[model samples]
Target: MPSPTHDALRTPAWTPPAGNTKPPLSSRMMRAAWRGLPARRYDVGWEPGLVVPAPDGSPLITDHYFPRAAGDFPTLLVRSPYGRGVPWSPMYGLLFAEQGFHVILQSCRGTGGSGGRFGLWRNEAADGRATVSWLREQPWFDGTLGTIGASYLGYVQWALAMDPPPELKAMVVQVGLHDPHAFFHANGALNLENALVSGVGMAYQHQGLAPMVKATLRLQRRLREITTARPLRGAQASVVGDVPWLDDAMTHADADDPHWLGTSMGQAAERLDVPTGLITGWHDALLDQTLEQYGRLRRAGCDTALLVGPWTHTSAFQRGWPEVFAESLAWLRAHLCDDPSGLRPTRVRVHTGGDESWRDLDDWPSSPAVTSWFPAPDGQLLQQAPTDAEPLASFRYDPADPTPSVGGPLLSRGAGPRDNGALEAREDVLTFTGPPLTEPVDVLGPVSARLSVSTDTGYADVFARLCDVDAQGRSTNVCDGLVRLRTTGQAPTRVTVPMSSTAHRFAAGHRIRWQISGGAHPRYARNPGTGASPVDATEFLPVRITVHADSELTLPRGAAGTVKDRGQPRS
Candidate 1:
C-alpha cells in the first residue's frame, strides 16, 4: 500500500494562520484569506483563491489556508469538496482555531473556489497531497501537521493519513468512512447512511443560492439523457442522481468493484503511523465505521483514543461537541507542539441518562464486557437464550404497512431526538422485555443480536431496538440498528443471524426488548422477503420470520456501564 508523501498530503497550497482575538477583517480580506491567500494589497482586488500546483498538469487545483499569526506553528488540515465556509469548515475553525493552533481548511476541486469536476473519492489523495505540500511552505507553519473533522471532512483526513505526510502528526475522525463503499453497503444492501448524506448534501449545496437557478440545477438534464431519460424507468437509475455510482453500484450490490475495493479505510490502516482521536455518537448511523477504524488503528500500534456519545449526526450537535473539541486541541498541542501538559485521561467516559451522570473507563470494550442471550418466546423477547424447545416469535412483514419508522439512529433533515412510543402497536412488529437490573447496568460499545430465525420466504429483515422502559411505560429508543437479511452472509433459510448494534440499559423494573420484523420502511426500505434484487426489483411477500432467541445480543458492558438510557416524561 503506497502512501502519499507528507509533502503531497497538504496540497494545492496554504496561507498564513489567522489572528485570534483580532477584530474581524473586512469581508473581502476575510474571504480572500479563507481562499488560501494573504490579505495583501491586490492590483485588481478580484481576491484570487489559493493556488497550489497540481502534481500532474491537470487543471484541477485546491484553495487552502494556513494559520495566520506566526511562523512554525503546527498545522491541522481538512480537505472537503463542500464549500469551505459551510458547517464542515466553520465547525473546525470554531473548534480548533481557538486552541492556538493553525488549521488548514481546503476546498476540494469543483467545490468552493477550487477547479475540477467532482463525484469520485479516488481524486482526494492527489488533491490532499497538493494541499499538504503548500502547508509546509507557509511561513507560519511549524512544519508539523495533523488532520481532523467529521463525515466527509473526516473521510478526507483519513484518506490523507493512510498515506502519512512526513509531518502528518495525528488525526481525529468522527462518524465518517474508512471504506466509502463498504459503508454504503453494510450488509450487501443499500447504504442508508450514505444515501442520506448524499441527498442532504445536494439539498444544502444550493441553500442560499439564487432560487430559480438552484431549482433549474436540481433538474438533471445530463441524468435524463445519459443512463436513461427518466430515472423512475429503472430502480438503478432512481438512486444514481444521489449516489456516487448510482447505476453501476446499485446493479452490483454484492459484486466486487474497484470503487468498492478502493474505499476501504481498514485496508488503508495497514500503512498508518499517525496517532488518532476518534469521536462518534452512539446513535450515529455510521458509528460502527468509527469503531472499526479506531480498533484497526489501535491493533496496528497507532496511538489511538476514542469517545462515543449518545448523540447522532446533527442531534445534540453544535453545543455538545466542544468537549471533544477541547480534547482534540490538547492532543495536538501534546503531539505537535511537544506540550504534554494535561494529557492524563479518564479514558472511556460515557454520559448516561437517568441521573445524567458520566461514567469513566480505562479502555473501550473495557473490562467486564460480557454478553447474555434471551429467546423470543410467544412473541416476547424472553430473557432465556434460545433453545429448540422454545417456539420462535413470528410476524408478517408487509411492505405496505412497513412497521412505521420510529426514532433510532438517523441523520435526515429533521430526525433523531424522537420517541418510539408511537410504534409499539404495529401488528407487524414484536417486542421483548426484561426485568430491570437491581443495580445500574452501564453498557457501552457495539451491541449485536445472535438468534436463530427462519423466514417463510427467501428474505427477511431484522430491526432491533434497545429502549429504556421507564416506570411509567414511556419506551424511549436509545439506540437501534436494522439488517437486511438477504445480504446477511448466510443461507436465507437460517432461523437466526447476528443483527445490528443497540445501546441502552434496563433499569431495575425496565425491560429490554427486541423487535423482529421484515423492515423499518422510509427509515430504510422494507425487505420484501421474496429474495428479489434490492435495486430494480420491487415486490412484496408475507413471510413468517421467527427470531429464535437462543441467540443473544452482545452489549458493550462498560467497566461502569456508563451508557445513559433515559426515559421520557410520562403523559
Candidate 2:
C-alpha cells in the first residue's frame, strides 16, 4: 500500500457547500439528528498510543489520524482530560481524521496515559503549550492548528488560547466554564450538587473507573441524598470516596480568593485573538459563561460566531447537529487554511424554544427593547412598578424540606427546561403570574431579577425562575438563578439574581411567571440559615422569607417590529 503520507492524501482546501441564502436558524436540527458520527468520510490511517514528552519530561499519550490518501494538512488538536481512545477518540480523533484533516487526541496530564499529577484546570495551560510544541515537530504538521471539543474538552481550548500559540488558528468552544470559581460558587452560593458530583466523577476517572463514572453520573436520587446529608463537608466520601479538593472548594466560598485566581481563564480569554466559535445549549449549565465569553472575545475584536440550541450538556454531545459540525469545520477551514469566506467574521444564531426555529441576528441581545415586570401582593405580575407598599409575599423555607430542583440548567437528570407546575404548587415556593399577554412577547437575552426580601433567619438563599405560562396554565421554566444572602439585620435586602439568557417567544394569551423561593435543593446547597459553611451546616433553621411586592423581573425583548411571526423578518 502507498505510504499514508503520500501526496495523494493531501486534499484540496475544504469549502462549506452553499446553502440557502437565508439559512434556517436550526438547519442542523431540521436534518435527521445525527446519531454517532456519520461513517468515515475519507479513507483514514490511525496511529494509537503515541507518546510526546512535556517540558518537564512527563509523557503525554496521543492517538494520531490522517487521511490515507494523504498530503500534509492543517492539524486539528483535541486535548482532553478524558482518555484518548474509545469515546473521545471516535468522536474527535477518528471522525476529524477521516475528513481530510490531521487530527491528534492527547490525554491531559494525570488522566488516560499521560504522566503527571492531575490538578484539574490548573494543569492545562502548561500541558497545552507543551503539546503544541510537540505537534510542531511532527512530520505531517503544517504549522496550522485548530481545536475543537465541548465542556472540559472545550475549556482546554480556551485555557490554552488565553495566550494564543502562533500555530493556533481557530477554536470551536462549546459549553465551557471560563471561571473555575463559578463552577463552585455561582452568585455567592455553593453550587453544591454539580460540584460534588463533578468532583467525585473526576476522582473516579483518575482511578481508571471510567465506565463506573459514566454509569452513575446522572444518579439524581443518590445525588439528592448526598447533598442533603448531614455534615455536608464529609457527605461526598459516601459517594465517591475521599476527594480533598471537594472539601477545599466548600470551605473557600469566596470566588476571588487568591487560590482560585490561578485557575481563572477569563483574564487570559480577554487577550485571545484567534477566530472562534461558541456552541452552547439554552439549558446547558455553562450557558451564562459561554455568552459572557462571546461578548468578551467580540469586544476584544476577535472574530466570533455563536450557536445555541435547545439541548443539555450531555444531550448536545449525544445528538449531533449538522450545522454544528458543518459550521465548526467551516470556521476551522477559514482560519486554518487561509480561507476566510466560510463564515462571517461575526454572526449570531439562536434557537427560540417555543417557536422551535432559528433566528439569525446581527449581534447578540438582538432585543432593542427592555421590559420589566413587577410582583403584586395578589400573586400577579404587573407591567408597571408598584406605586404603593403592597403586602409581602411570605414562604417558609425549611432546609430539611427544601424545594426540589426541576429543570432550567442543572448538572443532573432534571436539567434543561421542564414544567414548574409541581414545584410551583409547593407552599415553600412563591409563584407570581401575569395576566394573558395581548400579543406575543419575544424574550431574547439575559433574564434578571432584583428581589427585595427579608428573612427571619441570619442567612438564607433565594432561588428564582422565569417561566412561561400557557393558556392552559401549564408553567415551563425558561431560565433561573440563585444567591446566598445574610439576613441577620431584619432589613429588606435587594438580591440581584442573574438567570441564563434565552431566546423564546411567550405567545399571545400566555403569561409570564416568576417562581421565587428560598432554595433549589441539591441544585444549590440548602442554606442552613446559621452563616455556617454549607458542607458543615447540620443544623437547619426554617426561614420565613418576605418578598416585597415591588420586586422586579426584567426580560430583554426585541424592538417593536424587530421580531416577526415564526422568527422571520416581517416587511
Candidate 3:
C-alpha cells in the first residue's frame, strides 16, 4: 500500500503520441448514440493508471483525460467504485474531455487495483480530500474544480461537500443517494431487492467484465431461492459472495441505530451554497433522496435545478442517457466554464407519464390543487365519501404466499412501468376502481393514502398503490408506498402512507384504481405476523386485514376540472 514517489507519479502509464489525433471510436459511437450532444470541440488524450495517495497513503489508481488542444480548462473529478473502464472511461472521461475540460476518473480505494479495504462510505471523505490535495500540486492545476457523478459516485461528491474544497465551484448529482439509511430501510421496511442488487454490484463489478457478468447471471438464477429462504440472513452470501457490508446493512433496520452514525450526508445539502443540479427518474429507486436534497438546497438559498425523467435507476444510464447527459453538460458548462448559452429557461423539468412528453416549469407542482377519493364497499372509488356506517373490505395475507411485486421503482431490469393485471388478480390484493374518466387527469406532486385498518396480528404492513386502468382493464401502477403496522387491539388504527411523487396523465376513457395489499415481496422483505425481523424469521403466519370505508386516496391535481365525475364503478 506504499504511495508512489513524486517522480514516478509524474510519469504517465500511456499517452497520445502526436498532436491533433481523432477521437476514439468508442467516443464517436457514444456521441452518435447520444444524439444532439454539442459538437466535439477537441480530440481527447488520456494518461491511465496514475497513482494518487489517499489520506492514509494508500495508492488510489486514477486516470486523467484532457483535451489535446492547447487551452486551460476547469477540472471535473469523478470518483467511482465501479472501475475506470468501459462506460466510465467513454461516458465520463473521454466524452467530457472532448468537450474541453480535464476529467479525472479515479477508482475508489480497494476497488480497482487501489490500496486499502473498501468499507462502503467510510473512507470516501478522507480519500476525496486527499485526491484534491494531490490535484493542487499538479503543474497543470488551474485552481478551479467541479464534481459530477451518480449513485455511490454522488455519495462521494457529498462526502467532499462535508468540507468542500475552495476550488470546488459546482456539482451535479444524478439519481444520487445522500442517506444510506433511507436508501436501505425507508418506511421501516428493508428494501431487499435493491439491497441484494447493490451488494452484487459492489462485490463483482470492480473485478472486471467477465466476472461481473458471471456474478449477475448467478444472481438472476438464484434470486428466488435466496429471497425466499427460511432464515434469510445468510442466504444472500450464496449469490453475492462474502459481503460483510450487506450483512451489516440488512441487520441494522433502524435508522437511529448506532451502526448508522455518520453514514448520512444529508446535512451537507442542507447547508451547501454551491450551485448544484439534481437529476432523477420518477421510477428511480433513489428518487426520494434526490428530491429530498433538491428541497434542502433550495431552502438553503442555494442555486439549484431539478430534472425528473420517466425512467428507472439503470435506464437513466442507457435509454435515458441523452437527457441525463444534456442536463449534466449544461450545468457543468454554465457553472464551471461560465457558459450559460446551453442552459434551459426553467428551473424544473419533468417527463409526464401516459403521454410520455417533457414539460418545463418554474418549479415542481406549479401550485397544484389537492383532490381526495374515497374507497367504497363494492370495489368503487368515489369522489364523495360513503354514507354507510360500517362498510368494509377484507383480504387474507399469508407470508408463505406473499404478494408478488410487479414493477414501479426498482434497481433491477424489472424496474419501471408494467402491466399489473396478474398482480391485481391475487386474492390477497384489494382493488377499488373509479368510473372511466371523461377527460384526461393531469396529476403532479406528492401522492398519499390515509388508511384505517385492522389486522388479526399486531404486526403487519400496508402497501398502497395508485394505478391507471385502461379500456381493456389492464392496470399499470403509477406510484406506491409501504408502511409497517403495529397495533395493540382490534380497533382500526389510522396511518398515512406516502406514495412518493409523480407527474403523470390518465387519459380519457381510462379509470383510476387504488390497490391495497399487505406487502410486495422481495421488493420489500415480507412482514412476518410473529413480529420478528424478516431476515431472521423462521416462522411464517397468515393475517387477515380489513380496510374501512373511511380510507381515502389523495392526489395533486395539475389541471382544474381535468377529472370528470362519472357516476358508478365499472368493475
Candidate 4:
C-alpha cells in the first residue's frame, strides 16, 4: 500500500512552480532604492515649523509640499513617526512624484524635526486633521486628499479615516492593525516579548545621532559577523519589552478603556464614507486586524476595497511581489488620481495558492465553502469528516519544546511560505487529514470553529491550521487560527480565524488537513493555559479539551467557483 505521502503538489495553488521568478528588471536589483524612478522636480514649498494646534490647541508641527504648477493636484499626506527624509519606500519618492501626487511626508510630533510630544495613534486623527487644515491654506492646494503606507503609517491612515476631513478623499492601508489593544495584547493576553522588541526599536529610533552612530557601528560589526558566516541568533531578547508597551498592553487591555476603544478601526470604518483600498498578506501576524477592518469597511458600505495575498508582514517588500506596487499605483489612481483602471473590484480578489489563480467572489462566503472535520483515533489525520463519534483528542503544549514555526502569515523570520512539515507529528498537536478530493473547491472569507471541550485549568487555547497535504506527505500550513478555549461553550466562542481568502483546488487525490494544537508561538504569543495576568503571570493552565465535529470549523465554501475577475481560477 503506498503511503499517503507520495504527491503533495496534488493541487498546487497559483504559486509559480518552485523556481520561477520575476523577469529581471531593466533597473538594478537589490542594490539600493536611491536610483528611483525619475521625479518631475516641481518647486515644493516647505514652511517648516508652522505649528498646527491639536484639538485642544497643543502645538503640532507640519510640512507641506505640492507640484510647482499644482492647480488641483490631490494632496497625499503621510503623518508618520518615521523620519520624513529617510524614504520608507525609496521608490515612493519617484513613484508618487511621477503619478502627479503631492506626497507630503511629515514626521509625527517628537520625530524628524517636528514639534510637540509624540503620542502614537492616540493623537493621530487630530494631528492628521490639523495637517489637512494647514495643507488647504497652501497656494498649490487641491481640496481633495489621500494618504498611503503600511504598519504605523497605515495606522495613522485608519485614524484619519475615522474622522476624515472634507478634503480627505481616499487611502491605501497595508498590514495595519484593527485594534491596538488586541495587537499589543492578543486575545486578552499581553505579549511582553513583542512589546519589548517594539519598545526597544522605538527607544533606539527616537535617540538622536549619538545612539544612531553607535547602532551603525554595531550593525557594521553584525555585517562583518554575517560575512564571516557567524550567526547572531536570538539577539532579539535584548530589545523585547523596551517601551511604554507595559502600559499599552498590560494596563490597558480592558475594552472599555477610552484609549483602547478609540484605537479600534471598526468604529472608524463606520464613519469613513470615502473610497479606500486595503492590501494585506494572509500570512501576516496582524492579518486579523486587517481582516476585521476589511469586513467592517465592506459591511458599512464604506466604498472600501480589500485585497489579500499569500504574503507575510513585509511581503510587499519581497522580490516576487512588484506586482503589488503596480496594483497599489492603480488603486491610488482610482481613489486618488481618478483613473479608470484603478476602479475598485466588484468583490474581494484573493491569490489562492492551491488553485493557482486570482479569484473574485460575490460577497464573502454565503454558505459552507468546504465541510470536513478531523477523524480522531490515534493522532494520524484522516482527511475526511469523522463518522465515528470520538469524544476527544490530546496534545501536549510544551513551551520549551515549542512547535517549530512554519511558513505562513507570521511575523517571525522564514524563507518563503513557511511549510509546517517539522511540526506535524509533535505529540502536542492534534492532526486531521482529508481524503483526496475528486473535484475542486473554493474557500472564501473567515474559517470558523465550534469545538466542544472541558478543561480543568480554567483556560485553554485551540490552534487550528488548514493546510494542503501533498501526496509526498508534506503538510504545508496554508492558513491557521487560534482562540481561547475558556471562551468556548460558555459564551459566543464563535471566533472567525482569518483564512487566506483564495480559490484553492484540492484536485482529485489531493488531501485537506487541519493541525490542532495549543499554540503557534512568536507569530502569536503563546496562551499559557492559565488565564492569569498576561504580563508577570507565568503559570500554565492544564485542561481537558474535547473537539466535537457537530461543532466543527465553519468555512465560506463555493463549488469550483466561476471566474469573475482577471485573476480567474484555472479550471
RMSD (Å) of each candidate, 1 decimal: 6.9, 6.8, 5.5, 12.7
TM agreement with the true structure for every prediction: 0.80, 0.89, 0.93, 0.78
Q: Give the per-residue lDDT of model 1 (tens digit) for 477-555.
A: 6666666665343223433333434334456666665555566655554565567655444456676766654556656
Of candidate 2, the 10-residue stretch with the lowest lDDT total is 16-25
**lDDT of every model, 2 decimals:** 0.57, 0.76, 0.86, 0.57
Give lDDT: candidate 3, residue 510.
Answer: 97
lDDT of 2 at 568: 30
> Model 4 over residues 256-281: C-alpha lDDT tens digits?
77766566755887667877777776
Better of 1 and 2 by lDDT: 2
Candidates 1 and 4, the one with greater TM-score = 1
The residue ranges of model 4 lying beyond 4 angstroms of the native Cα positions read 1-71, 85-91, 191-197, 200-242, 257-259, 365-370, 378-389, 400-404, 487-503, 539-551, 559-571
Candidate 4: lDDT of 545?
56
Residue-wise C-alpha lDDT for candidate 2, range 385-476, written one tens digit per residue? 88854547898999889888887676666788788888888999998899999998888898899988888876888898999999988999
Off by over 4 Å in 2: 1-40, 205-210, 213-221, 339-346, 559-571
Query: Candidate 2 or 4, higher TM-score?
Result: 2
Considering summed lDDT, which 10 consecutive residues are worst modelled in model 4? Answer: 224-233
Q: Write down the RMSD of candidate 4 (Cα, Å).
A: 12.7
TM-score leaderboard ranking: 3, 2, 1, 4
Q: Give candidate 3's whole-model lDDT.
A: 0.86
> With candidate 4 superimposed using the best TM-score fit, by how many Å does residue 249's alpha carbon deviate from the native?
1.6
* Candidate 3 error regions (>4 Å): 1-34, 388-391, 559-571
